[model samples]
Target: MLGCIWQYFYSSFLRFWLKWFLRHITGKCELQRICAGYKQGALRTSQIGKNCNKIIILTLLRFEEDVVDCVAQIMRHKNISEQKDPMFKVNLQQCLLQISGYNTLFAAVEDLRKEVFDSENEDHEKICGDLLMPSEKLESRITKQWGNIGFQGDDPKTDFRGMGMLGLVNLNNCGCAFQCRYSYAIVGINLTEMAYSLLRSGALKTHFYNTVAGKPEMQNFHQLYCYLAYEFNKFWVDEEPESIMEFNTYREKFHDKVKVYLQEPEVALILKLDAKN
Candidate 1:
């Protein structure tokens, strides 16, 4: 028992001595700082790889203070201008790496514009699953359902002309039967818009960086979207607001909720929807 206790003390002293020696000799290595940033939520794992490319440059320069400032900015949930500031160099690097994934999602949405809903459109029926109507009344029928799903106008197909295919798939997905009434298209669209708004406001980067830290993929991005949908639906009915008119107010509140949730490293963003539950 004494031997074991001595061994533990000896190892602890060795670690302390090594850190002291390294601190004096290296003046704080970049790798160590980067690791600290990740642990403290200032630097993301996704941001580390790119930083390696500038290892020599970063190591020679002292950015330890920047890291502290960056973390402070993030914890405070500062506006996006902080993204461009030197304090968030690592955070900026992360966003740069994720640009490809963002573009992929955007291009996928744009590709939908080319797909017109006509007799040739095989997915048209598939798009309107249980929502039935006479064949000749297709346009009007589509409009009412689209309106039900939160689209405007009598000609719904025209709206899809831009991101038609991509948007249609998401809309159809929400409209599908889930617990007979839980998966409302209107709610789904609201979540989509909310996610985009977060992205636009730049708050999404922190949550997203924490989510897909090392490798940002399209699936993970979609998963985030799905999380929003699943969460917002429950939030909507739980509040029991007077009407949709109060959406803007609630939307801001939900965004703040997500920011708070992202502060924890172990907290996961998951998508689980069940009407019966």
Candidate 2:
């Protein structure tokens, strides 16, 4: 109860006066101080974003192309002088770009998720083929050979139900990128779901903000999937669950571990395919 009252008091009155006092002494607004003090990435960006007007942030989220204008507006509103602090403009612009780019990437990913996987589509066929059997051709589209890569049934198409083409794309990217010890396609699809959950919940912001300075692309998302695929395999090996049936339990444990990593300001969940130190 006291914490809640203190928070209310701070936001309602103390915060404004605190900022005013800081600006009076430092001759720098809160945003400028944040940009100057914190290094690039989520550490800087998240603080600047939190202090920004909600309306302006919403505009940037919708039209990432307007980030320059958004930053200019923020500078003007905050009474920041570019002549005195030249780097402030550049730093704040980069933060806005990273913030907006994440939203754009999520929208792009959602579009792919909504797209149904077409069996006759040559591009789709090729991606799946390259994933499951890069060295040879399938006897037929519906052949049981898909089981070799860990599809649950003779047909792989049905497996793309909830995730749609997003699952296939992630699966293909993971398969082409690494050698798997688990049921490859099944694990890839499962990891795709994991990736989607992380993206939707905004848990990926820390990783993306650290890695991509500007707009994050679909390829960035693919790289994240690869990271999860590789790390999860390593995790599975270390845990050595009784069988695949215990996947959910171990998967949740791994998810919690990754979440803990994300909480760190310097988190960058990249895949390093090498022997451990």
Candidate 3:
């Protein structure tokens, strides 16, 4: 009860005066202070998003370019002077780019997820088959060979239902990059779902903000999927689970570990290819 009252009082009245006093003392608006004081990445960017006007940020969600204009507008509204704080303009621009880039990345991922995997498409078949069995030719489309790489059945098409092409893409791009100890293709697909859940929940903001200076692209998402796939594989082997039946429990443990890393300001969840050995 008291906590709710304090929150109401703070947002209703104390917040405005607090900002006014801070500006009077520091000669910087809340946004400017956030940019100046906090290190770049989720810490600073998340604060800017929280403190700024929602309408402005929401309007810029679709922005691909001209983010400078949005930053200028924010400065004008906040009465910030570029001459006094030259870095603020650049910093805020980067933050806006990261913010908008996250939305763009999510949309691209969603579109890919909606695209059903086509069994007849040569490209899809090649991508799927080559990732699991580069040297060997498949006996048939519905053969038991797919089980070699972790598919539950003879036909791998049904496995793509949840993540669609996104799962296959992650498997092909990230899974093949490493020599996995786990069931390569299916585990990659499962990890794809894990990556998707993280992206959907906005848990990757810290990692993306720290890694990508400007707008993140689809490649960035793919790279993150790669990191998760690699790290989770290493983690699974290290944990030495008694059986595959414990996958969910170990996956959750790995997910929690990754979440803890994301909470840090300097988190960059990149898979170091050189360190794979």
lDDT of 3 at 256: 92
lDDT of 3 by residue, 1-277 (tens): 9999999999999999999999899988888889999988788888887887778777865775657778888888878888989999999999888988888899999999989999999988888887558888998888998888888999999999999999988887776644547577777788899888889999899899888988999999999998898788778888999998898899889989988888887889988866535
Error (Å) of candidate 3 at residue 74 is: 1.6
lDDT digits (tens) for residues 50-120 of candidate 1? 44434422332233344344344443442333343455545544433443344444445444535565534
Q: Which sections of candidate 3 miss by over 4 Å?
A: 177-180, 274-276
- Stretches of candidate 1 exceeding 4 Å from the true structure: 1-28, 36-43, 46-150, 158-166, 174-183, 200-202, 263-267, 273-277
lDDT of 1 at 236: 69
State which candidate has the highest lDDT: 2
lDDT of 3: 0.86
Assess candidate 2 and give its lDDT.
Answer: 0.87
What is the per-residue lDDT of model 2 for residues 1-277, given as tens digits with 9 covering 90 to 100? 9999999999999999999999999999988899999999889988977887878888665676698888888788878888999999899888888888888999999999988888899888888876568887899878888888888998898898889999998877768443547567777888899999999999999999999999899999999999998888888999989998998899899999999999998899987878641
Ranking of all predicted structures according to TM-score, beginning with the best and ending with the worst? 2, 3, 1
Error of 2 at 256 (Å): 1.1
In model 3, where is the ten-residue run with the lowest total lDDT? 175-184
Q: Model 1, clash count? A: 2
Q: Which pairs clash inside model 3?
A: none
Cα displacement (Å) at residue 102, model 2 = 0.5
For all candidates in order, the CA lDDT equals 0.52, 0.87, 0.86
